[model samples]
Target: MTPRATTLADVDRGALREEAERALRALVGREDAVLREDQWVAVEALVADRRRALVVQRTGWGKSAVYFVATALLRAGAGGGEPSGPTVIVSPLLALMRNQVAAAARAGIRAETINSANVTEWDAVHERVAAGEVDVLLVSPERLNNPSFRDTVLPRLAADAGLVVIDEAHCISDWGHDFRPDYRRIRTLLADLPAGIPVLATTATANARVTGDVAEQLAVRGAPVDGTDGATASALEDVLVLRGPLDRESLHLTVARLPDTSAQLAWLAHNLPRIDGSGIVYCLTVAAAQQVTEHLRASGLDVRAYTGQTDPTEREAAEADLLANRVKALVATSALGMGFDKGDLAFVVHLGAPASPIAYYQQVGRAGRATDHAEVVLLPGREDRAIWDYFASMAFPPAQEVRATLAALEAHGTLSTAALETHVSLRRNRLELMLKVLDVDGAVRRVTGGWQSTGEPWEYDAERYERVAAARAAEQESMVEYVRGETCRMAFLRRALDDPELTGPDGAAWRCGRCDVCGGASAGVAPDEAEVEAARERLAVPGVEVEPRKMWPSGMAALGVELSGRIAPGVQASSGRAVARLDGIGWGGLLRDLFAAPGGGGADLGPDGDPGPRDEGLPVPLRRPVVEVLDAWHPEPAPAGVVLVESATRPTLVRHLAEGVARHLGVPVVGVVRPVDGVPPGRHDVNSAQRLAGVARRLELDLSPAAAAGLPGRAVLLVDDRTDSGWTLTVAARLLREAGAEAVHPFVLAVG
Candidate 1:
């Protein structure tokens, strides 16, 4: 039986809106479910008017509902005979995609997602989408640029897609707090889209500037002229923007000024149970998240660590644990930030401040979403700025490096990322990010085999990049101000996001009357003395395993280095230990300060002609950790001597550290590997291949009679100030093994 259908000309506007409301009610499984006026306006614009729109609303504002409702109404042929094509949503995170799929299922809308994790199912998914069996298709921005998808799938999808949705739209703007280079590919998708196909871009954290940028991209050029207008006109200025106040009334913001990392961990251990329900404890780095997770677990609290390093299955498990309230918290990095849905999350605590106020706002927005009151606390650490500086250093490689990458691609015709790495000095992550940016700018194209330059006249745009960098630095300063400012905490955040509602009729910032400063809430609440002491002990206990590099980096020969394949098992350095990662909690701050540049008051090398003085020794706190590591190592054939990797930059510190370890282990001082003939000082900034080549050419073992006679047939403790690529340790260990040492156990003050 053919279903009754009405054409667009015969459609009743009032009946269409009523049908949309019914869809919303079915979506939420509640008869009382009704769309907000703004949400309805967005839905009407998309389904009724077939116009593009941008929604910049706060978290929990039902931005998803706007798209889902529109998808249902359009797919059901609101005023037509046949079902419309599927809605393609460009989402960012897998967790978010999963949530959307489930939500759509509840609304009787069939949804499917294509992402890296489900590569094996892509063919089936594509078939379903092609056959119109799928009503909604979710894909990550990165997937859009995939060779197969871009060449074979995207054309059909874009041509027939009923609506194109870009979630986390802030990522499209370079000025956004979490700008993703791949998100820029959406502009290409938008441009290729057929006219009259409405597009919806949504984000919870875009400020006015980001809103304008996103809206401009959504605008359609040379759009078909409507008959009513009787003239052809572009749709560039027709983007409907719906922005709401960036305020979370349920959140009670506060800052707890702890003396150190130990105190902060102690406070969390003491206060987590007191919070209303399960939540997240955010850390600025993966190492810190692991550290916090371990400490909390030791305190008998249920917690898990979530970071980029975690396995896919484990991350999913962790998310499930949080959603089911099976765990107290998930100590996580920014990997868990966007689109995680937990309506009843009651609290959010930060071990360290994020680099920008915008990022902080988005992270904290996850809590107090469904509850009347949720605690949001910030434990600002002194080391936050240094971490920020480290990340900032990786932003859009210098013009020279970018040009080198482009030139390499042009010269080679097609080169993979690994092949390109040998031609450029940027590391893997930075190189990939740079390539994505260039790809979006039309300067290069990624093919099946690799990337190829398009010969487009691309400018480095140094001035624009510099402006962005300056803006980032200013944001970091604003974050610091937010932490230490005397103004109302919520008000300060709202003002930072440029929330119009923050200003009253008189044009003055309005106090939220909910934060610590405005509400007179005490920030000293903490765990009991016993728990604090336990947490202190757990944090103070330091030692991180430094896994030895077993495999040589590929493409060494291409870089003119004659090494390849896995390092010989017998020559590999045994598993190593460090006091801590330079970015971790506990002793990380001290190590960071210790290794700081000379201009920052850190130790400096002696005058050029010498190996530097050895009077300066290890600091007292570091001394105990080194001894603890040595005692815990307990090598099978106990070490017989200690050998130091001479540091051109901090000779005195490395010498003392090696000597202290030897004394504690009662092992004799073997000899040091000194820099040979004037091979310029090794650079710590280059790639593994370059660093290995430099170290190989520069460092040589001191083959003195004492060293040769004392080293054979016994394990030796190889000590260094730090280990980055482990190439230095690999070379040193191989040399020692060849010199008759049975094994070398590497130790370091810190590991990158």
Candidate 2:
């Protein structure tokens, strides 16, 4: 049997343009909806010319329209018979994919998604795709690298895919604002594509550098097959690059400079209702988002928290609620940034500034898409840089650590991620990211058992990584400058992206006249004294429950640790308490300062630092919160004693906090748990298994006879300065339970 042939040689250009318009009208459900010239050009390039293209346009500039229109035109053959192969789109976030699928459906295109969240439906979706019952298939980049998917399904998909789409294409470049190593797998996909297949890469944020890198990657060629020369493949120079002006005229940008988190929260609570409509409240961390959500709810505003930690169902509900204007706002982290399509979103308020202007642009762009005017505010906080620094610390592992990982992988035939962590000090996330980077570099391969070395010699590319790090540092500084009102906020961001539209005939920068700086608007927008006081009181009243670890991390025994399975409920610590997370917007500042290294100022110093003892006891404000927590706790049977975890670094601070708590509660001070066996202070910089192992070997119980005698069936409060892994409290709780304490309640000043 002969296969049917498909060709574009007979395509009628005039009819193609008409069909493109019809497709756009169907997609947007508006007869007046039409394609911009650049959009048309992109469609023509893909459908008629069969050329790869990169479209760098603003968030609402109809980038998706270009691809959807192209998909429609390509699927409807030039001669009009059976459709072509399915369009494969590599999307980043599930939210984005869900939106894309709906949009495609509007255009009468059958679209399906395969991602981590829809595991049960994967088989059905795959069957549909293979049976030619699907028009478009959206998948995450991570799925592209999955062992089974890559080994079996992907090859078939790539071979016959009509068109390839890389959404959020900036992620293909390391210098992108939100770089993901998994996106680099797209290069392999591009290389393996059969000739004449058009590929499209789309992104809302990409500087000139990232743009060039993505374009180059899109032009990469497949290896020579069966001794045939592959040098004739098209180079990236031929790739059509459509870059549009990134100015969003409807967005009225402003920065509200408040003195502290309390003032920021107060301003938000007071002014959120004044904003035009439902939108997002961007936060820098999950804890900050949760804190902001709670504060807003207390102020009678309907808001929800949206972060990576949010349950999938809850996230979908929150998104739906915001879209329907049922909630005033969603206090969210970057998890809500990309590909969320709400045409009438009226505002975006950042509780704290993002680390980079590109990131800030992407987030704020979520608003003012369909409306004539929408508010975008940035409430810059003092702790922004600290949060940036913490993230920067995870950039790329040191060269030494990378070398050690490669050595370990080479020694072992195959090792799972958990097993690899036991051999290296890097955390699970960072280690996994590093391995992905290596895999793309051809230094390693993920097999059934785990990852194995490819025995390929690879250089660390230290200079390139250093440059990327330096670029990030520069971006951070620019973000600080943005908040400082050093220039027109809109112009500053345009220049940051190297947008050509911002340059005038005389070579001076053009101001959009919509930002607070350009409009001579006041940066101080604090609410009245009473409201500010209320917010301050709310933030000051601090206490967070530290849910105990139920089950130990899997594969602990592979690390030579015997601990495994669920923690015995009888010996476990009750849900504990912390004054705040170190990254929280409220008590975070004070707690952060309290936990700062002694000699290094505010820097996070490791165990090597002195962290000199201070004479100051627990602050008066903090003391009140501790008592408030105790009053609210109402632990059954009450705590009979207080047990302190001896702090090797901040001994003075820990001792003062313990004594203060004991005195306030009128409870006896039980003997402290001391470090033993010459074990060094537990390093907070390592992985969970390693940290827990160290804590298990180092900590020892030292209960006085009187305390021991009273511990038969009494509850005790175990206090510590801070917790990163919570292993310290876990081990300490075990020790106290072994000493016959009926229940252990762990409390800490902060949790990192």
Candidate 3:
């Protein structure tokens, strides 16, 4: 490595560019490495004028290059004396940060990161930063609101920081495809910075609206406290916005519509091997990703799975395996998206459609970054819209829920998230998200223990949320149009993102001589009929192990329920089976369709058009699979009779399913148990403690005359339409045991 550049204020402009080129060469370890014109423009803004810059460029366009180069210049400007305070990068994922730290090292810039994975070393990392031994310090967005970090460390870091970089800046904008509430805290971070500390924000997936939103946010010097308006700040006028065309010339885009999950898996098993190099196969859910991974490996191909639920160490190993080309592809969800750097990734295939074009573009951008040629394929499933709707339902909570959360915080003064769950109905994840939003809006504050209200009156922005919801709907529709192939796929995406380079100076539409629509669709090497049959059989093979709840959810006692800690082995339901998971790539599609709410958003509405799991009989096709799963299942102590758990909405379906299971087992229907009168019906979406509380309230065994005759000292099968949180099964099994049943075995058609 060459010696570091010294601070030189009198250097000529041309020489400054040359110095940047030298730093880039050292960074990339290539003598020919040079900064692109746009990259240089961003660096100059940060280094020369101390101005904010948002560089919206393609993946391979060296967005990281701009920041590292700027950091080098800013540090060198301090000369042999104390270097400027470290450049603090607010990154989204540890995977991204790790890759960036490696890249920074190549440039001789010492980069250190503090993320959830490396909590033990955070104090050391903080000490290094304080000593100016770190050039760039990467921290996750969540770190900004961490009480200790925010109150103690952040103020100092903000005051002493040379430059601040927000990687994945699109997340800051509500209009962006993947918005996070934690990212909103960046405005507070920026507002706290000392004057003249240049901030740089970078992203590859922002459309025109997101770009404006992010750029305005980067210019937070004189912006409003809430930023809930169109009022222009004087600082916004000065921020530099560097946007380039998003076209990936090396990518050959294709969208193939498949009839069902079986065909989609078959196509992947067939085409993945023929796609040349290692790449990615994205699924809409964790279950789907795991299934695809299993299918690909069973087809004698190298594959692995990456999802949000994967362990941290295993995720790192999987990433390394992919980067080293040890695996042909990683079947993954959006957890693999955003800032995962694999330069030579040859292809990106989506097993299902993403809800937004920009989000899809971001995922596909993973491929063809450094390669001269790469494949980008999307096999849109028939169930894409339903899956999209399922995810869309997880958006911001209702006004009443948000207000209730704030009220709870106000009433309690300060409550840990667990304690707060008792005061409000929202699940932990959704509740934390609401608290972050409240923190960002000045309605609450995060402290050492948990969260507290600021006693500030805040009105729900129903109109803004409605507008965002409308925008999301429009994005989904545009994605559908893209799948229909009404226009060139590349052109459609470019236009959707409002790419300024969609047209030339002559005002003609830009056309890429690639993609299924632009270049005529090809009959690519197809999977054999045998492969399709195998995939179908795999989908048909049912039985997802339904592990009974081993322990009660914490805080049940706080709700006046006595349950807590480990469930008694005597009362615990034996490990059982479900025909399939509601998120699986196999029977999941059928389950989703069967259990869909009236509006097609979730598995909530019954056939009577009411909320909760649908009240429908096990369909003829699903019945066979359920029976097969039971026939194949061998419980330790055989169930003596069926004890049907009466469903709030699906009583008929539960009875019908129970009868079929009983016929298969050669057992009698001995009992039927119902919830106590006026008890709240099954609530599937609540946190575990709340769900357990509801289960305790609702469960009361009223055995029939036949049960009275046969129930004593006999094992019974607990039947239901589905299991969510498995609380109902747990509590019901306890009741059955208490009613003189020797052992309880839980059976369900699906795990939703």
Candidate 4:
């Protein structure tokens, strides 16, 4: 590495340490604020020695202080001649960037961020960085890959950068929980960086494997980081690993094994107040987060819902409320993880366990950062594994699909994601994810329009993908083992994360003496009977508004379907209703069980050679709820008949539901909207465009005189087993309305 900053030997020791202490006082605004030994060591290494370092300390350990202080001294040319360029930091979340920006200002450092949320400020921010008015510039991982930024701004920044920082560095390692494909671009950035530019990588949750992986990734200085000829690179050329113990003395950890989702809800409602401060209640899915938020609010607790699906504005508002202690808690999913800091948060409760231990540690690390005492509780449910599997299904696609995607991009120089859908049947998210992975793999490149192949040979690494999958499965098992073990809770976590200091020089294992196993905590008591009953009542209430699809998916005609644009008001179905969400707290469990599809579960034809088998109508547990739904719903003109959306996979259930609803309405069972003979039965879980094209091609009303005569002329309730993307219900309703029915209203068992 080229040397641009001051050398360690030439600087006077006394003056340099005093200047560092002076900067620390200004950064923290404390008269007696002095840097800890390790913090001082890191600063000296970066500013004086000019070397790359990786610090893996627990939360609230002054890691951010190390970098900010370094930035201040380096910008002032502390006992040196030339001032360094702005320090570019690659942060993972907008919340983290906000916190960093504010913290930087407290230290008298001029900081600005460029992200999707602040697009209007990009030019101004860039100008400030160029004019040396800004000391620190923060950018998200995604912003690094933008064609404009990569081609224009990045080259200049790399040529003159004085320091680089990667926050939440654990995300850059695939072995770590919460691996992001975009973070892989950091390797390229490091390769392009000019020599003598000191770098720093920090995280609070990386294990031994993840730490090594991140160190290796950060060593790419225009060549392979891992030396294979005979010798490996030294610390001066790569990274200096500074790892400390991973334990929180303030956290009072406990595991409460609840019987079901309702019981877990009851426990939160009963105990949140007793914990005595504002905090967070975490759920596994968006549906659960919404359900818990609604139930808690109704129980007279002030709270809000925060999830991935929540609006960006609302997320900001919720974060502000939580920080200000305006609400008791924010019932949220993992979307609220990492860099959301509150000094005195009283507790962190999980309604469902995360898939891995590192993830759990990262989340709970948010709380008790500035406080000496806080509660950390886990309420594990049987449905946790199912939720994990659901998320795990979003991994890299098969080799065939990857090759097909590459071929399509090669054939067409530039294609938008929507136009690319014309060639591949994958959903938007999965397709976008695959494209990103391929981009990093050197087989494709994103451009002005969309994406283009790089004309590079690409081979799918199936074995490596398998290894990653296996590692994930093992982490899940470790999470399960954690809840069931009787050993030291803190030690178990440390070992899982491979904390180096866990087994100290004394050859003894470390224990927190504060967790449930250490007999320093207590939280196993059940909730009150009254609270449980109230939660049950709330769960038992059935109804979720299923909004109909307003516009058609783009590029449907490319897939041999003619539908496009908005559906006319005359043919569109009115709003609809469902019993509950498949991942909800009340009827959610029952519906999941009712619709569990195992090996052709109701998919094939019955033994009698009939298109749809005859079976018992509506399960016993669901009959009264269906009646309750009808009683609560007052559709216009009432229903003249019930028309079944032919479910080739669940025809028996669909037929039974149609017959039951028709009987209750005192009307006839209208003719079924059968699938066309040649089309394949499509899945309900794919993306909007793909699902829409499939439904349009598979479903239609018979035009034969005999079949047309059975159609209903007035309003009808269009019935189906479930609604996923809502495309099935929308397309089927349009077909029925155009055939003969005057109006359509959709009803379904569940909305997933």
Candidate 5:
């Protein structure tokens, strides 16, 4: 019986046929003539639906071909409509961008990447984009964030943007296997644009979170499929997450710790067949990559190092060599795997444990690109755990420290980084990271001056940070447990690690079954178990309590205050935006200048309205003089002089007098208050009083006391380091009057 396919009138069969033919022709021209049946069906469905689609196929599933071929047809006017200006592809890596550009050119499509690693001239590219001369624009997230690019080119493209394709769309989610912070902002960028541009988010792998986040980021509802008028995923096979036996062939899984590069090189030399293919050797740091590259070169292996600092041209050349089979191995630090697709890798050696299992999976996934038997060698040493911990530590600040910082800001209103150090004692790097987290979490808001508690002062919740930290910790522990599980390693892995792809009943056939502990072989598991337990115990010691410490400049204690208590300075306090304010003292003008002046020897009063400056620079606070009173047995010059004192105490008053005598000679000063608790008072005499009173006028010294005993023996004097406030002198004078001292006068070192 012949089956007749029902063709709906609304479905543009002519357009679909034209587009399909155009794409087929382009593919044939590019020497990629073979198209799987599913690929054809997917293309037909997408053309009929008139919606962007996601291709969720595995690494080698011809995913890129689906999009490129479809693009070619659309650009060739096969869909019975004029194509948009260009197809905008937002790739995650520079190498991927380059490859796609080259692929497009080969297929007779005008495509170019906008990313410039090192270019003195970007004007031509920007102008081309603005003029809509290019068929496609490939850019990185960072490049997209450029205001110039966004303002100059993106708006023009938005109007007729054919499709916005995100290659590594899993990066949209933090829970994605390969997450990047910049990737999270793409949704916002697109949402702000003018046009209702169709977005095509594609990735080789996606967990539930990644899938959901990608859909959400692209503004898709329900499944990211055709019916939603958004995207339809090609018929992708269920992800084959293979978990195999811990055997000699599965050299990567057998290690408790990744071995050094030297050991890995030797292992590779011993086991790997030189089949004119290249491999990647991943390390935790650039130094490790360099070290491996040096040794590998010494061993006559074609090797190179790729790091963050690697030159772009050199990096491209090295990758070209690897792809061309001119190099056997490339030692790198997370740089080689994501963007470059060298189809014939024989091995991937991880020199240390990645910070997370997903990272490990991503790194290992670089190998076995072909259907051939390839190995992912994890040469973990005893130090690998520590290295992983170090990585995590760098990624996330101590949650407790973050919590403490939040609490301090809430309670104190605002804090400079210096004051924050005292409250939440953390190293400079850790503190910066914590502050950033706090800013991101919105528990604290970083204004120009410092971090202000956004919520209430008592809000010290680090629940989310702690939860993430704990989840990551559990994940790491699970990996360690996998390494030491006593059961059949393959079974343990498949059951525990959620690897569903190893379908055969006898998993041995899928991977190495002759592991040391498997097949009646001894792996010395007991010793390893002990070592694991010891390591766990060591890390289990409750992390040190995170608390903020109040720190102050040195020599502050000499002024009768603790080093930690005096003007907590770094940037500026959150509250009180003023040059300086002191009342009742004649030196108010001077005090203002002392505190408000900007240059050295003056406090940074900060702009009047803006919150004080942030403590990013860790400025030094100016030290002001202290007021010390001395006992001269001076009698009252005025019948009702105010008494001014540091602490309203006899000793401080006496010290103030001695210090003021030479500085404030002939200042008419009187102390009213006497010592409490029967403390000895300053000597009372007419000559001392007259001399103090006369000099007090020049220095503006004041004294006041409510009673004879409370009076500073009419011998009170006012002195302060800087005159940020006239209040010190004024306050001292009032106190002297209350202490029964006569005319109160004031004296200060310098006025604001």
Candidate 6:
């Protein structure tokens, strides 16, 4: 791929470019009513800066104009056309990219967009990128996550890129409503770029903490312009917000009880008149959604349902209908959030409680985008609240319970909740609840037996008095903080939420003054200093202190042990030191500190680095004297095979030895173990005999019936992962001789 620089003459810049510049300069120099004074100031801030600093302006504050001015400066021939790297803009949403691209095309700028939607042929895209035909490549983070895309396109962009723009930059923070795991990796992506690459992060909503987080995530210095909250409030005036009368509306909450979809269908039929505009009925499950769609269609209400079960094509069609006003209503599961832009929605009805508060807010926000008044109806039931409560539990776990669970695990090697509750003198149900919370934090993953730590857990003591008090306070405050105000309810909401829209007297008023509690079309009366101070004092109570913990894995001892001897077996041994070396000198001190129980015996000198307790524990098999050469061995074929048997008291031992030799030589090994005194010859325990035979089958060796054998001192090796004593190896080798071999040798992985 070759890089090409685009000349000013290459794009449509005849008279349109001049007109755009004129229009832009007129607004820049003088305050125009259409362009707010603050908006112009924001544009100047971006244009005036030599280095990039983020403009954390509110939504609908003419943020696009700031970029326009910057683009014009970069291209106005003040600095000659970019020699290499094109100015790159990294947008979070494809729609935002499309919007920005359309706006730029109108202004006569030579801009282009390359994202997953386009650029199907990656190699061709790279070629064009290197050629430098594109002035701006609008991309989503998802496209960048592709390894091929990163390896190919990013490098070329990095080489000549001047500016990188990130829209909705709040998503980069954990606190963002939508937290993408991969989004966290973008910090590294930005940092690893060429030194001169400057990042621009813009978001509609950001609190102080989120602003700081965005700056750190992007690795940039930020310059925040004040009054953004007011700007957003002004934009909301143009948006209609209708609040339904609490008692007058014909709204009765109905829940889909009884896995029966009949009740829900009947309710939708009864409420057809209320759902006048394009409506949405949210379902909790895909099966429910499907049933509702089927039953609703039978009753004749242009309904379509979407869930994860729907194919991509079906989902896209459903979304297109909703957006194009073709479908009357959409009955959907929670999979309908991202990139949904249906603005003129009249009603949104919740069939079930949503997964989380954030989800509920986002879904509700989708409606009444253009209208002055929008209605949202929530239907609550035991099932709905149960699902909601489950999520809430995961989101905000009881700190006392989490701390107790973690402490129990730390004290005991590993504790089951059943056992831990007994040990802690608590109920099993309560303990289970706490463990579930830890599970949600990604601190642990549930296993069949118990939980395994996935990452470091947040250190929290749910039982501390301070923590309990804080939780109680936060719970109470969420319910009682907002009341009727003289001004519009939206203003009170902005004040309560501390959104970027609570600034200035003009911005303090809602567009529609009839918002329920605030029935007046003006700003509410300002709170006196005394009331304000009291509110502040109440809010100042500190939140609970969070402590982090890491889940640790145990159970290494139960994986079975390895045995080895001085002699080399058929297998090769590397030059690394044995486990015993790590144990004798370095391990004891380490184990004492880590586990608080010191092993003082020879077993403590067992395998190097092995964490086995040294006192009164059964000696691990790996510490035995004989190095058992047990491997997935395949023996070679020979004219005569050797019989190998130690003095095997058990036929199982004899069969094991036979199988090992059989595999090594790729021939059947005959077993010949002498019967115990006065024992019936062929009446061995059939169950145990059958089990030994099964071992032979697994090793790909054929076991022979008892046969007379004789052979000694030729050359052969016995292998096993474990060896307790020398007697088994001795009898096994004797049996190998009785069958017909020249020699028998014994080996094991370890000697204890």
Per-model CA lDDT versus the true structure: 0.82, 0.82, 0.81, 0.80, 0.50, 0.45
Higher-lDDT candidate of 3 and 5: 3
lDDT of each residue in 59-178, candidate 2, tens digit only: 999999988888887787643534558899999987898889899998899999887555546788999998988989999999878899999999999887878999999999999999
Ranking by lDDT: 2, 1, 3, 4, 5, 6
Could you tell me which 10 consecutive residues in candidate 5 have the lowest summed lDDT? 542-551
Runs in model 2 lying further than 4 Å from the true structure: 1-7, 79-82, 224-234, 504-509, 520-524, 545-630, 633-752
Per-residue lDDT tens digits for candidate 4, residues 319-433, read 8788999999999888888788787889999999999988999888888888889999999999899989877877778788898899998898888776788788788889999
**How far is 160's C-alpha from truth in model 1 (Å)?**
1.4
| Residue 444 in candidate 3, Cα distance off native in Å | 2.0
| lDDT of candidate 6 over 1-752, digit per residue (tens) | 34333223433333433433454654345433243454444333333322334555433345566565555555453233443345677665544565577666766555666654343334554567667565566776755545555676677676567566666666676555444444554554565555444446665444455556666555422222662222233322321111111111211222222222343445565564455578687787664565466456546677787765453334555666776777777888766644355557766767665643334444555566556555655553346545544444443445565666666666664555556665454455455545654554446545544554555757664454355345434433332222212444344333432455445785555343444443322222233445444434422321110001011111111222122121222222111111121122232233223223353422223335545443332123432211221232222322244343322222343355446445655654544334444332222212222322222222211235433322332334443322322233433443443434444544332222
Give lDDT for model 2: 0.82
- Report the number of clashing residue pairs per model: 0, 0, 1, 0, 104, 78
Decide which is better by TM-score, 2 or 5.
2
Q: Candidate 3 or 6, higher TM-score?
A: 3
Model 3 poorest ten-residue lDDT run = 1-10
Q: Name model 4 segments beyond 4 Å from true.
A: 1-9, 224-232, 235-238, 504-508, 544-752
Instruction: Identify the candidate with maximal TM-score.
Output: 2
lDDT of 5 by residue, 544-609 (tens): 110111122222223343322222222111111111223212233444444344332323223323
